[model samples]
Target chain A: MSITEQRPVISKLEQQELRRLLAENKRIDGRNPLQYRNISVQLGYVEKAEGSALVELGNTKVLAAVKVGIAVPFADTPNEGILIVNAELVPLASPVFEPGPPSEESISLSRYVDRSIRESKSIDLSSLCIVPGRSVYSLYVDLYILDYDGNLIDASVIASVNALGITKMPKYVVEGQAIKKTDEYFKLDLKDHPVSLTYAFLDDKYVVDPCLSEEYASDFTVSMTVKADDRFCAIQKNGGGMISPRRVIELLERSLELGKELRTVAYRQLAGGNG
Target chain B: MLRSNEQQQRQRPIVVPGEYVGDSKFHIPGLNVYRLSDRMLATTVGLVRIDGKRVDVVALKSFYQPKVGDLVVGIVKEPGTAGWTVDINSPFLAFLPLSEYPEKRIRLSRDSIGRILEAGTVLVGLIKDASIFSSPVITLKGKGLGVVSNGFLLSITASKVPRLIGKKGSMLSTIEKGANVKLTVGQNGRLIVHSEDLNVVMKVKEVIGMIEKESHVYGLTERVEALLAGRRP
Candidate 1:
């Protein structure tokens, strides 16, 4: 019932050691500044969900499930389907998380995923229209944090993208004024793959995919979602900190390279079923 | 006193809650076991341990239940008017009253108390009082108990604390000697590793990680010894 977000108490000794390691372009986990932890993707993890995926970014685990339902289209975009993203930081995921209303951290995490998918045109929303302005398929992406080690943004993004990619919906035909369900089913047409990369700034240096302890010791984190074509679709910054214009440019360049690598890894796992 | 059955002790099997463990007439309920009529059932998911006539379930994972006289490492939380709230990695937050502090003739103001132990400060203390009615109280009046100025904190499952310490502190001594570092272990499953060398600290962390993962398996001590000797197990 505790809604307050409890930040772990980090000791001065840890902070100093982390900073000292960062000064030498090293991390406590022995990774380089730009190196990400091991990533594993499991598609269709939930049998009941229309589409589901569980992604593990190091120790951080996020499960994304897609549920399709019929709803009236929005007035502004009648021809497009609705994509609703909701993220829940389950209490069992970490000691800090509690059972209550969704925290701001969770709300913002969902919004970041929503923006990345919407802006990147990952799903062909227009194809989901049964009757313009009357009825359309609404895809709901629900993210559950199973384990929280750190860098949840990246893990959630990967899970969402993979879940949406495998989503399948029943076919519907226009019958005069009403929409009728057909026996045939069709898979969602995925247009692009978007992957997010998060970096935590420690002192003057930054480390990609910071672990839980590093996150507590860090100043802030910047997350960027890049499309398959090397174009940025979404950018978000969390925590209280400042970043220089030059450093922003450097992060963007790194995002472009790492984004492709991540997409490949995600897709290869899904296709090979090696996860 | 009842004697231990070596054959039964060697075949310790995992059991779920409500599963029948043994007959009540022959076995006594202990730890996470309950006597349901004439049968003994497990009250939690854990490995069964039969010591003499006592049938106890060693839970694989559980929250730390604070007990009196337990040494604990806690982090300073909010500073209240009467005392400071401390998080001891348990379900309940412990209280550290100003009176319990070793210092005497101290100012009673909140500002003065905050100066002594600010939020986020890590300290080692002993649980002086614990009950279901109120939060546990920890006192820093004992020897080797006070503010910890240096050391890296690492947390593991509280249930695995015994495995990490091993028999008669044998595993702990082995780790300290192998890694060349000092460790302050808390009953609440928090550890403070003190070493100037970063590599030594990392080595200790790796050993702890190994213990946490392989605690349920047999031959853990030998594997830990192999790891400490810088050989792959």
Candidate 2:
């Protein structure tokens, strides 16, 4: 998540040009109005972290680092493990981001990313449990925003899922009262890949993956995370404008369609070792 | 680009740390590769490049490593009594002492230093002194190397920078001629394209993306020229 300025961040002339381009079905970068920018995922970026991925979607960039720790399981979900998502918008990314605590935008970003993975049941949380209620593996997903152009949520979610997918847990053998870590490591059980789609509603038209300049041209932004099965796992609408029921449903349909296209590329790249 | 005989002898395989490259007897361990008894192991993810007895791994991803004789754009982050702590987009912030300002010999006082460069000032300078133990140093004691008046600043992946600046700067000239923009590319990944027209800036961005996406393919220079000429559909 990035700071959403109170006033218009883009120049009026730039905003006018963006709208004019969209009206003519021409994107500033020559992509179709319904197209998303090219996304490339680089895994194992932060070798120190348990698992990490650097996700680049056009000019926007985000890095997700996963750190696994052993902790007590929650009382209610004693059988399941915990996954905490934290996002930080680095000041080096843009001028608007200040050097300080996490912004409200970043907080929303972490929650949305957490919900997408959680609601989609992408990881087998139960498998992360070591001892029913006594001990469980805690996966901490720290998202560091390297650069913010636009559509941070979509990029963040993709990085988080792929980072978790490539994660491997060291073998743990529990004694009478002590848990010991072994030299062996087992790959994580990644079940599904979920992708998020951001559509900017501007003048009754919804454009996919709005760039930073184009972001300021829209009033309402609808973002939805779709699972591999074409199910909506997470959906959000940033404060701006409203959409009718028909429009929301139509956006959902489009999200599912784009979700398949993005998933194929995302997973294929995930399996590719170069990342 | 033609490869040296030794470069051809050394296989440029993408290797991760701890992966064995070759037998040390056949190939000597070079930069980013360590010797372990009889085998040479890679220490990073990069293409292994060898020139004669010297074998080195060229990493695709690059971090700003300040070295002597490199031209860099420095942003003034701190203007203190000692000197200015400039953000060179590196692991360590570089220091620009007041003495290295120019031959005119500005006063050593803080006020005099402020006159040269204040916080938020961006200057193009050279890495005069660089030591891993100490903060790297920069100097603005050369021509065309001083505070930038105004220009468009942008960055692409540092690894992809080589593609933008082609072999022997062939690609850089291609972009400058095709887009009609004077651009100075910093090895650290940031670039300054001097153009007031937004359309020109936008075109440069397209040119960069095209090169980055198709850098591996052959005959990229002509494709970029044709794209600039509006011959591409």
Q: What is the TM-score of each candidate against the true structure?
A: 0.92, 0.58
Q: Lowest-lDDT window of 10 residues in candidate 1 chain B?
A: B1-10
Worst lDDT run of 10 residues, candidate 2 chain A, spans A7-16
- Best candidate according to lDDT: 1
Q: On residues A117-213, what C-alpha lDDT tens digit does candidate 2 reach at each position?
A: 9998988899899999999999999999999888999999989988988887777889999998888888778788899999987787779999886
For the predicted complex of model 1, DockQ is: 0.52
lDDT of 1 by residue, A115-204 (tens): 999999888789888888999999999999999999999999889989987888878888888788888878888788888999999878
The superposed Cα distance between candidate 1 and the true structure at residue B178, in angstroms, equals 2.2
Per candidate, native contacts kept equal 0.45, 0.00
Model 2 earns a TM-score of: 0.58
Point out where model 1 deviates above 4 Å.
Answer: A1-4, A270-275, B1-11, B108-111
TM-score of chain A of 1: 0.94
Q: Model 2: per-residue lDDT, tens digit, B159-189?
A: 6677789889998998898888898887666
* Candidate with the greatest DockQ versus the true structure: 1
